[model samples]
Target: MAKSERDHQKVEAAKAVVYIYINHLAYHISPETAVLYFYQLMWDRLTPECLPVRDALTVVIEDEQFKEEQGLQFINRSYYSICNPWHLDNKKRPYLKQIIDRLDREPETESINRTTQALREQWMNFSKGEYGDCLRRQMHLGGHEIFREEDREFRNVLADYLPDYFYLYRSVTRTPDIEQLEQEHSHPEYSGTATKQINRLRESYDAVYEYRNLRQQGVTGIDHPSRLELAEFEKGLDFYYPGRNDSFKSKARTICHKKRRYEKYASYRPQVKEYLMESVELFPARTKSKLTESIDRALVRFDDRTSMDPITSKSLFLGLLDSVLLPVPNTSNILRLERCVGDVGPMNFTGMLLSLVLACPMIRFRLEKKLGYLYRKFEGKSLEGIQWVVDLFEHINLALVMNARKIGYFSLTEPLPDAA
Candidate 1:
């Protein structure tokens, strides 16, 4: 099949999976928890550049303070019987059988360290060679993994910022066109502190996105970036700006051009420090009038803003997002699992915080390392109380996918061509 046809099929498959969970499986478990499992399965099935055995062994012996224990467990117990490949009589495990067959074809040899290196070499070669095509297809068509069957309550007092499952499921079934999907990713049901802040962020990011596009199209004078220039450029566009004043034009120029001005005055900089402050301020009011006052106490480490990159800034943003519910500011260790509880519970609050973070186009994929850190930290814990963290991870996964759609990597909304 053509690549576009294959892509269409892949997306259709994903949508079907979403439909099954929302309509059937969700009747038994929390839809939020199921999304967590969806992301876990996708990661387990898709990312095996080297030997699965090697990865499992690495996690077991990994010196990294924050290793994801569930990574190995989820793959072994769910994907296939990788632990005992020779006992592969099960037709359900074709993927496992293929891996063993590949190993069988390798030259007969054995060594303590050399054998280990050989398996690594074999997987590397296999993943980069023609077999790689099969791997991608197999990933999408892989057998179902076990799902957590019980519904769980959140540990903290989290407000319900998510749409009802019925509405969310209905929305998924009626997947909109790519254009509409991009424009209305936010749901009306979500109007928590984080949601409101994210909406503000979306406005700022939209302007930045437009400014970047205009510059790339060879719009002159914006190369140096000034509101005066952007205002003149805007006059030609279809968008209406009620106040076409100098400061409004100048503010646009600042946001698009001052990408790395994180200093003492960084708090006032557009789309950088200022955006961070606005998002952070959405935290519930506590003793100091702003709950973020505690969070910013930890920002002292980031004082040397001169060397800070977008990743660091993103880390800071998500850290504060995670800490929004904290009784005290401990941004040093975000997602403070032990202290994640509130009267309403942590699930909805964290989910809302994550939704807001994903609204900003700039930080969409810029903070993967931070996310991986949180996943590792939360892995192996009971899903009964902390399912929210898993739910949070899935939100990140959805955010990343939407980011890809925005950039046109693939499409779920492509209409089938007219039949011949």
Candidate 2:
């Protein structure tokens, strides 16, 4: 094979492994949680080769080509079942029933057996089914070549790749019979390649774990708005409180009053009653004005109220956060956000909106869950494509550092305390 062909082979192989892993999770666990794991896995650990695979898995979840039917009639055309598993046909294979029962019953050591079954089934069904054209073609090619092998040889080769299939399986599903799996999948001929891939997958898992641990530690910091964004910003005033407090809200409003986060970047904000405007490409002209108006009103209420109730603040903050993070329901909105950020930097758009919420400690705490929801919502999207969101996340991290400093949570100037 040529160099390009070799690279293409590698990419396709990676995609097949990832695809099997995700579908295995969907079959073993709920489809939603399965997608969640995929999102969390790739959210912080996407490589150059992971982009197209991410996009392909997304098609399995929800193909946008049939948007009109899915949106209007509430169809479930996605290969991965987002429906209640019990509602699915149980007579045929009982895959859905077994999945639902596993959730309620004790954790079993049947993961390996189930995964092998899922892998074979997915490979057999891997053709030009209801999936996208590119995926269909790739599936047809892989199936044609692989299925042509003698049954015994095919089974042995698939078993060799069991470790690859269970790469993500261990994380999402219950405990598996690891010892048996290792013994069964151990092929002296392909051991070298299998060992290399297993090591790589473990390293990736460790990296993600460390990143998440750091994220959890730092998710509770305050962010300072730039002078251009805010006329005069005050530092922390009990900004890390986890729940609703009228006093906290009052103190928060005092931190920044004349909010100018929207003005300096998008001149159109001043023209449109100072609302947070989503990308024109993402939100249509008809709906854009309405969105901005809703956000603007919420911010005004949040800022101007002297004695805002917890209920009102909660609703207002959630409205603002949703508008900023998930302007539209489409996955393309995320891609559009990256493009939109180019026009106005992250600090101006996403960073600015986040800063507004950071003022309210109650709402500030909700940021973690909201962002997690975004991650799960657009699970399987390539990190490279969503670099802007990642950048905004880093921006939030910086703000948290500042918040920590202002609140005397820690001092950069002082030495660390001994762990004794």
Please write out the lDDT profile of model 1 over residues 1-420, one tens digit for every residue: 898676555544543443343223223444344334433322222222324433443332222221233222222222221212212222424433344234234443343453343434434444344233222222211121211122223333211212111112112111123213324645322212122223323333344446656766888654322122344334322121212353222333444355453433244223444534543344445422343454565355464434445666555555554445332334544545334334223333433443334333344332433443443344345555655554454333333322333322222344322211
The sequence of per-residue lDDT tens digits that candidate 2 reaches over residues 56-131 is 4333223332233221111112222221222232221233323222222222223244333332233223222222
Clashes of each: 12, 1
TM-score of each: 0.32, 0.31
**Weakest lDDT window of 10 consecutive positions for candidate 1:** 158-167
The C-alpha RMSD of each candidate to the native structure, in angstroms, is: 19.8, 21.1
Leading candidate by TM-score: 1
